[model samples]
Target: MCQRCEEPERPEEERYLIEVLDQIRENGWCVQGVLGTGSRPSWAYTAGLTAQGLPELVVTGLLPHHAARLLNAAAEQTLHTGPPVPGEQWLLPRLPKLEIVQLSAPAAHLHIAVCCYGAGIEARQLVYADSAGRFPWSPQYNSGRGGQPVLGVRHA
Candidate 1:
């Protein structure tokens, strides 16, 4: 059986997409907006800063074997062996291509949206560093620096 997390509040089929996804976002990156037409593989993407200081949607979404595969793919792509200094930005010369797989009934359907924006970052830039100083992104720094409403625009 799955390592269920308290069985959740809603029924097994409720999706709870917003609740779960929002919780994931709390781990890192501010959710600017969610995209999709209520379709099976909709995306809750966040990318570059919009004119309103909100994260822009560049692209992108979880569990069971299908979800595990997706998460693993994303993790593999974003894996790093170093940390970034302040003001240091990484240029993504190429964006990795992802293959979207569709899962069916009772198979644990989940969507894990992972995107790398800014023309200079991988998907992992959205998270803070680990205790060993891995990722190097500080949620506080991210919010304090590029966060806050800047009259709806990025300031140099």
Candidate 2:
């Protein structure tokens, strides 16, 4: 029998961890998405950047593919230019200016990152603006139910 057959099967979590590590090794980061409940908006986050001494990223109220694209772009930028600090505004080509806010409760929101990198993992939420260029914090901005949820307190 092959040496591979000698050992017992690994648990799902272990297998998942291996896969995530593989992705990180290949791509510098891995994106994970969480489906929303009726009361929560869908969200996605990067999981591997923190290992590179970069803050992981999160975005809410977008479809999985959209969120992944945004995160991937941001991750690429961050890798080349270093991570953005909380309260900084980042402008990506063809996208509205994004506000970077440090997550107050990363452990509560970034379950996947916490599982992979533990509770100490740092994360920043990329807060997108509306079509009218109004951010969620703006009193005049219109956000329907389950719209973008800011995972942290807005910086002054």
Candidate 3:
């Protein structure tokens, strides 16, 4: 019998897991979005990249669709160029430069990745700059409160 059948109590959870697995089987990765609360910024992350030996990608502050596009593009690039190291900058065509930072608290932010890959899963945050090209750590960067949540520490 299938695992889902074995654990009939968690029908919803099983269904969701099946969906994630199916997406990963068809696409290279599965993107999950978390809507932000009043004090938090919205974020999106990839769930299956770790299976490909690449750290999952996370991007915060953008709309769900935009974040998914960025994660998908980054996943594709990693398939060709290998995973990016923390502190490295990535330039995708027609998008702002993104700085990769290893997530300091993956368990806290990446619930889906943790659920899929367990506690030891790794992820990198794709930090984007404001319109003026100033990063979040910049003193003059323009953003509303909780506009862009940096999931990792900035490496100088």
Candidate 4:
């Protein structure tokens, strides 16, 4: 099931998120769905990463209250699953100061624009305005039917 839509799509972002999460598991972290549609929302699994890793939810096109509810649900589920792997130790000890911009074309809006630094603590300032152009990260998204690796190291 999709976090945005109740029914799943052919090429669902949730699946991609899961795949990336699996990669994280092999490399340095673990990811599981935290919130979505259904009797048992999909996000029950990801609560453990909040302490040890960067566990977050992307809530687009939802009201502030609804988003809060989803977040709370995710937290409760996380607590139910188990505590973080390394307790208070974070995966990315030296997190970079970064900003994220999300564009909603039809609305001509830049619905989400925020900046944050460090691990787990994000100071968000959501801006609502028409976007000037495609966001910087847009180029990183592959339009291919097959979800190929964006960057792969070649052996000599």
Superposition TM-score, candidate 1 onto the true structure? 0.22
TM agreement with the true structure for every prediction: 0.22, 0.89, 0.89, 0.24
Residue 30, candidate 3: Cα error in Å is 0.9
lDDT of 3 by residue, 116-154 (tens): 889898889999877788778777767543377788888
Write the number of the candidate with greater lDDT, choosing between 2 and 3. 2
Question: How does residue 141 of candidate 1 score in lDDT?
Answer: 38
lDDT per residue for candidate 1 within 1-156, as digits (tens), equals 332465555565444444444554554323333333444332233322222232222222211333233333333333342322223333332322222111111111112232222332222222212233332123453333322111111111
Q: Per-residue lDDT for 122 in model 4? A: 23
Kindly report which residue stretches of model 3 are placed more than 4 angstroms away from their true locations once superposed.
1-10, 143-146
Stretches > 4 Å off in candidate 4: 1-49, 52-54, 82-156
Tens digit of per-residue lDDT, candidate 2, span 58-98: 99998899899899999999999998788889999877679
Candidate 2 yields a Cα-based lDDT of: 0.86
Candidate 2's displacement at residue 149, Å, is 0.5
Residue 134 in model 4: shift from native, Å?
Answer: 27
| Order by lDDT, highest first | 2, 3, 4, 1
